[model samples]
Target: MIYLQLFLSFFQVGLFSFGGGYAAVPLIQNQIVETHHWLELSQFADLVTIAEMTPGPIAINSATFVGQQVAGLPGAILCTLGCILPSFILVLMLSCLYMKYRSMKAMQGILAGLRPAIVAMIAGAGMSILLLALFQGALSHIRLGNFRVVECMLFLVSLFLLRRYRISPIAVIFGSGIVGTLIYTLLPV
Candidate 1:
């Protein structure tokens, strides 16, 4: 029963998540965090972090992590399979259709129209993650003192490095970790 539930839950995630990994974050969050109540909000954030840090797609990674957390190894397998099935079928069908209709004006217009919706989904997910990180997932009742000062500074610095110097994101990620650790270590707690 648990395996079935896991499979169906993630199957829905895979079926409806149109834009990509980041765009699926909210959907994944809704299924795993809100609907199932399988994980706390903070844990979901950590799952996102782990998903991002690891290789492969975020939705798949999230399914595996959440499934494992909820119901161990079999759950992970079912969830992973569920998450992959839709995309596999979708890509195959879409590829065939796209090849056939590559020059169609309506097809191109449909594709172009989807771009902004995808961007909105990605931006919404990013903002949610940022707020979660800044407030330590306590977004319901934000107060000035609840903000993590170090995290804000780290965010600013990371943005600066990305925007100003065009540093590789990998370098920026590791650099932020090192700087964050040093700053936290030296600061009075």
Candidate 2:
């Protein structure tokens, strides 16, 4: 029963989630945090961080992680399948239609309309995670004073590196992790 719930939950996420994994963040959060109460917001944010650091799409990684957290291996498999199934079917259908209507103005207009919505969704997800990281325990306790200076610095530096220097995201992630570890170890709590 729980497995079915998990499958259906992720299936819904996969079905309605347009654009890419970043766009799916809100849907994942709504299902895992608000609707199902399977994971707290902070945990979901952490999961997003981990998912971003790891290979593969954020949506798939999140479904697998949440499923494993809830019901172990089988849950992970089922949830992953559920999350992937809808996207797979949709993409197959869309690919055929897109090829047929590649030059259609209506199709181009639809894609153009989706572009901004996808950007907004991604931006919203980034802000949510930023809030979670900066205001430590904000999700669980609603505390706004517990600002993490080191994290903020890391975020700024990472942003600077990525934007100003055009460093690869993989390098930025690893560098930030190393810097964070050093800070935790060398700096007094």
Candidate 3:
């Protein structure tokens, strides 16, 4: 029964979440934090961090983490499969139709309209992460004022390294974790 519930919950999430992984953040927040109580807001924030830093889509990582937390490895597997089914089915169905219609002016216009929506979703996800990170004091949560300065610096540095140096994301993740751990231990909040 628990497994079934986990599968169904994630399936619903999968069915409706659009605009890819970042877009799913608000929905997951509602489902897991507000409706289901599977995790607290803080935990959801941590999950987002883990999801972002890990490989694969953010939504899948979230589902797997939540499922594992709720009911272990089997639950994680079921939830991941359930969450992915809608995308798999829809893409398979749409591939034929899309191939036919992709070049149509009206379809192109519709897709153009979707670009802003996707941007908004990505922005929302970024905001969620920023809030969570600040709240946890992980990303320069302390300052007499202008605490965001630290966050901005880190963000710029990360962006520069990623864009210019083409550093692998996995390397960044591991480096950040080690650095954050050391910071947490050495510094007193």
- TM-score of each model, in listed order: 0.93, 0.92, 0.81
Report lDDT (Cα) of residue 127, candidate 1.
94
Q: What TM-score does structure 3 among the candidates reach?
A: 0.81
RMSD of each candidate relative to the true structure: 1.5, 1.7, 3.7
Model 1 regions lying over 4 Å from their true place: 185-188
- Find the number of clashing residue pairs for candidate 3: 0
Instruction: List, residue by residue over 17-132, the lDDT tens digit for candidate 1.
Output: 88999988999999988998999999988899889988899999999998899899999999999999999999999999999999999999999999999999999999999998
Error of 3 at 160 (Å): 5.3
**Which residue pairs clash in candidate 3?**
none
Residues 1-189, model 2: lDDT tens digits: 999999999999999888889888989999999998999878987899998888899999999999999999999998899999999999999999999999999999999999998889889878888888888764556464788889999999999999999999999999999989998999895
Q: Residue 147's C-alpha lDDT in candidate 2?
A: 82
Instruction: Point out the higher-scoring one by TM-score: 2 or 3.
Output: 2
Q: Model 1 scores what on Cα lDDT?
A: 0.90
